[model samples]
Target: MIQSVRQTFNQAFSPEHYRAFLDKINADFPGQLDFRVAETPVFVPKVLTDKLLTACNDIVNVITRSDFKTLTEQAIPEGQRVPNEDDHTQFMAVDFAVCTDESGELTPQLIELQGFPSLYGFQPYLADQFRANYPIPENLSHLFSVANNAEYLERLRQMVVGDCNPEEVILLEIYPEQQKTRIDFTLTEKFLGVAAVCLTKIKKEGRALYYEKDGRTIRIRRIYNRLIFDDLQHYPDLKTDFYLTDDVDVEWIGHPNWFFRISKYTLPLLKSPYIPASYFLSDLTDYPADLENYVLKPLFSFAGSGVKLHITSTDLDAIPSEQRSGYLLQRKVTYEPVIQSPDGLVKSEIRMLFIWPKEDERPTLLTNLSRLSRGEMIGVNFNKNKDWVGGTVCFFEQ
Candidate 1:
């Protein structure tokens, strides 16, 4: 974080301007946003930006390990492993808390990493809206390895739709119309020509998958997968012809197996100065004496579900040894409230988004998204009736 940049942005920030920014977003894509947009974009200086990237690379080292798949073989639960997993994930998102170290210097600590797609379709647009609506510094840009938004969208087109006719590549979701992230799906369609197809609507004949659109049935050649099994499990009674575990004929972007392999399950496998001390609950013979400083997280849950901020030895002992493998004990990283808002400082969590083309050796760091929070954690439930706190992008100092 840059103090000077933050000060300048805060001094110039006005509620009226924020109102207009929201209005512009709504006008551009009416009712597409289901989540709150933070009033400001984070101004990250080179020091913290470099640290974030370094932390990402450190975690990626584990994901890219030669035997990563073999090591995480048990991560995929029974009846959950999808068929035809690719050599590597097409997308990865690594989250970090902007924290202070023992020396009181601002540093990044790994929070969670996922081998899944984030708001890739909408982040660039939001970043540009921040630029158009405010006086963002000339030296900062939200993009990486590209010159501008156009180039970024071009790269997205290549990764998501490839050379196939856009209609043949669908952004697959369980129910495209209802997800909170449907805005990104709409934007993806607008920019890349790929339509969002619901799993229920997909008609499967043998190994081939097809979805109806515009009075015609379209064959699916590639799938930009956005559905996760956790959501699908919610509707157990719903019948779908095309199941994720089915060995479909279509290629997958963001294969389902990687979601399990590179999730919280991989935390214990990572060893980095930037990463917090993490261990599988099953492997810990003795619980830490200071259990208050560690967070108990379920290996399979998402969106902060099944996480206990405070725990005791008794709590740890209560879990059956057989079920302990499904949980993780991670040293807590204190979030530093650094972003200077109008009334108070706000803590921020930045998720570094990356894309790995089929031919690439590693994921390429692109733009990033940051969540501002005045509550205990980063989510709508925690930050109720909060301002200057929600989903937003980061402008890294060049």
Candidate 2:
């Protein structure tokens, strides 16, 4: 963290301004934001930024290896693999827990990485609101791959809605309206011109997809997919015309297969000081002696689902041997409480978001989403009645 930036931001922060900020967001899109927006942004110093970039490149190197796909073949559940997955994922998000090294200096430890999209649409808008209302230094930029917001949006447009009319490309989700991050859907349409279309409403005819818009039906040319394929299990009772695995005439931006191939499943393949020790539960012959220092995680779950922070040999043994492959045994990184909140210091988790065009060889880190937590981990359940704890953006020193 930049001490001067933090000091000035803290000095300029006011409850009234924060309230006004919330009011402005609500007024712009009433009742769309179900998640809390943290009161302040994280000011990341260049040293830590450089380290984070190194950690990212190390993991990306593994992801970009020639035999990466062959190694992760079993990652995709047998019946869940989608049709016509691309050569690579168009979007990727890597999470890091801010921690202190042995030398007592700030360092980023890899928590998890996903070849999936994050809040690519809303992060820049969130940064703008913070700058407009707060005393943020001009040198600190939230974007890296591009110069400004307009260029960033253009990059997204080229990747997500390329060659086709905006109406022909949809942000596919299970129920776009019901998702908590609907604010992003609204913003995506505003900037990218792609509308959020629900899966249930898709009309499929002879392997072609179409969705009803304002007055007529529009053929789908591309899918900026946001739907988690596993979520379809929740609505098994409901009938749908289009399924993810169905052979459809469309381009998939964030191909569903990469979500699993590059997840906790790939963690064991990475070798880096920033990446904590990770092993598939099914692959472990002998449990570590210090099981207390590790956490158990489901290989494919999101938003902190089925993650056991504190674990033991007994806990590991309880999982059926046949089902162990679905889980991951990961060394836990001690989160250093570093963000100076109003009442006390809070731990921060940074999710570095990247976008890779179809033609690009590697994904480009564009922006970030930082979460402040005072609880055991970063999520909604961890901090219920907490302030300065929730979704936020990071201003990296240029």
Candidate 3:
């Protein structure tokens, strides 16, 4: 964080401005935000930005393959496994811990990667609000190579919408307002001009899907999909038409397949200094004698639901042998909160956002989301009532 900007911003920061910020968000959208919005934005330094970009490239390389079709087919044994959970993971949130690499140099290493979505919509709006209310440095930016908010939106459109009219694309979610990440859906709708329609709201006829808007039925051409089928499994009673495997005519903004390809299961396959060494539960050559050093994670689960941190041999043994195949033993990389915390130093992980150009093979590092925590885990519940710890985007020096 730059001291000059911090000094200027702090001088201007007030309770009134904070109130206005919330009011502005409310005015911009008619309802509640899905995820928690922090009072301030995190300032990212140059070193961390470089490391994040490098980490992203390492991941993109593994996912972009000439023989991806064959590779994907081999990876999935059944029709259900085709998406590979982490495959068409449209939004890639690579969490990084600033750590010393093998050469003893400080570097950001991969802590985790999720197939889930983040605050793509709220970040730009929040960034603008931060600039309006605080004296952020001119050189620092929340927006990356794509210029300002409008350009960023266009880039996102290209990523998800392509040449299709924006009105035709819908940001699909399951009862979006009820989901924890509803704010993202709202933001995506606002910025991308895509409708945030739930699975229940979608109208189906033959093989087509449509949603009504302003007295008109807009044909669904593309889906900026945010629905998690895993959650769909929870509610077996509900009949929904937006099943990804249903052979719908619309193109997926974030292909469902990428979610399965680049996940905890694939982390073991990606070799990078920025990434922790991960082993398949089935393929682990030799289990660490000290199981305490690693965390056990199920291949497919969201928001740290199935992670067994502070792992023990007994904990690993308790898992049924049949179920063990679905998990991975990931070496724990200590995340040191180098960012100054108000009370004391707190650990932090930065989730780098990316957009893969349709023409370009690699996805470019765009903006970032940062999470601060005092507890061992980075979940919001773990850092409840904590200051400077919540859902926040980072403003990095360009």
Candidate 4:
């Protein structure tokens, strides 16, 4: 973090200015902002930024290996495997917690990585709003590998829409309008021509998928998939003509199989200085002596679901022997309260977004989103009735 810039921004900050910033975001897309926006954007110094980039490269090396998929063949759960997976995942988000090393120097430690799409559409809009409402430095930028907002969106369009007509590509999700992150869906439709279509809404005739739009049947040639199989469990009774596991005749921009292959299940396989020690609960013959420093995580859950920060032998033994393979024991990284908030210091996590086009040798790191937390963990339930803790973007020193 840049102390000088943080001091300057905090000194200039006012309650009225923060309200106006929120007003502008709401006015841009009415009622689309379902989550709180942090009062300020993080100013990341070059030292931490360089370290974060290096950590990402280390993880990329493992993911891009020739036998990466073959090694992770068991990651996919039975009866949940999706057909027609792409050669690689189109999107990836690697998370890092701002931590202090034994030397008391600020550093980043790898928290988790996901081979799924993040807030790719709404992040640039949030960055522009931050700039419009505050005095962000000219040298600081939230974008990577791109010059401006237009360039960023253009690159995203190329990956999502590709050679196919924008209208032919659909952002597939399960009742996307009701989802909390619907604002990104709205922005995705506004920036790109693709609209979010519900799974039940899709009509299937043989291997072809179609959806009714404006009273006309439109063929779906490609899908920018936003649906997760875990979310589908809540709607077991809901009937649909097309199943995700069914071999369909459409191209998948972000394949569903990659989501399972590159999730918490892949954490133990990764080795990096930034990455903490991790092991599948089933494979651990002996528990570590310092069990308090480790956390138990369900391999398939998202958004911090089913994660126990405090661990004990009883907790580990309570898990059925047959079901232990579905869990992970990850050493918890100490999140230093580095970001200076008006009330007090807050812990932060930076999620680096990336895009890996089929032709590219590896994934390209693009803009990032940072979450400020004043509670036990970073999530809606933990940070309720809290200030300066929610969704926000990060502006790094160029």
* Model 3 stretches astray by more than 4 angstroms: 1-20, 67-91, 99-106, 115-117
- Give the least accurate 10-residue stretch of model 1, judged by summed lDDT: 56-65
Q: Best by lDDT, which number?
A: 4
Which window of 10 residues has the lowest lDDT sum in candidate 3? 80-89
Q: Is candidate 3 or candidate 4 better by lDDT?
A: 4
Q: How far in Å is the alpha carbon of 382 misplaced in model 4? A: 0.9
Give the alpha-carbon lDDT of every model. 0.91, 0.90, 0.71, 0.92
lDDT (Cα, tens digit) per residue for candidate 3, span 303-360: 7887888877777778787777688899888776555544455566778877665457
Q: How accurate is candidate 1 locally (lDDT)?
A: 0.91
> Higher-lDDT candidate among 1 and 3?
1
- Model 4 alpha-carbon miss at residue 347, Å: 0.7
Residue-level lDDT of model 4, residues 1-398, one tens digit each, is: 79988998898899899998999989989988898889999999998899899999999999999999998999999998988887899999999999988898888998888999999999999999988878889899999999998999999999999988888999999999888889999999999988999999998998999999999899999999999988999997989999999998999999999998999988988888899999999999999999999999999898899999998999999999999999999999989998998888999999999999989999999899999999888888999998889999999996
Worst 10 residues of 4 by lDDT: 79-88
Give Cα distance to truth, residue 205, candidate 1, Å: 0.3
Q: Stretches of candidate 2 above 4 Å error?
A: none
Per-residue lDDT tens digits for candidate 1, residues 180-256, read 99899999999999999999999999999999998999999999999998898789898988889999899999999
User: At residue 128, what lDDT does model 1 achieve?
Assistant: 84
| Cα lDDT tens digits for candidate 2, 1-398 | 78898989988888998999999999988989889999999999888899999999998888888888899999999888998988888999999999999999889999998888889888999999999999988889999879999999999899898989999999999888999999999999999999999999999999899999878989999999898866777887878999888988899989988888888898999999899999999988999988988999998788789999888788888999889999999999999999886788989999999998888888898899999898998999989998989999999986
| Candidate that beats the other on TM-score, 3 or 4, i.e. the better one | 4
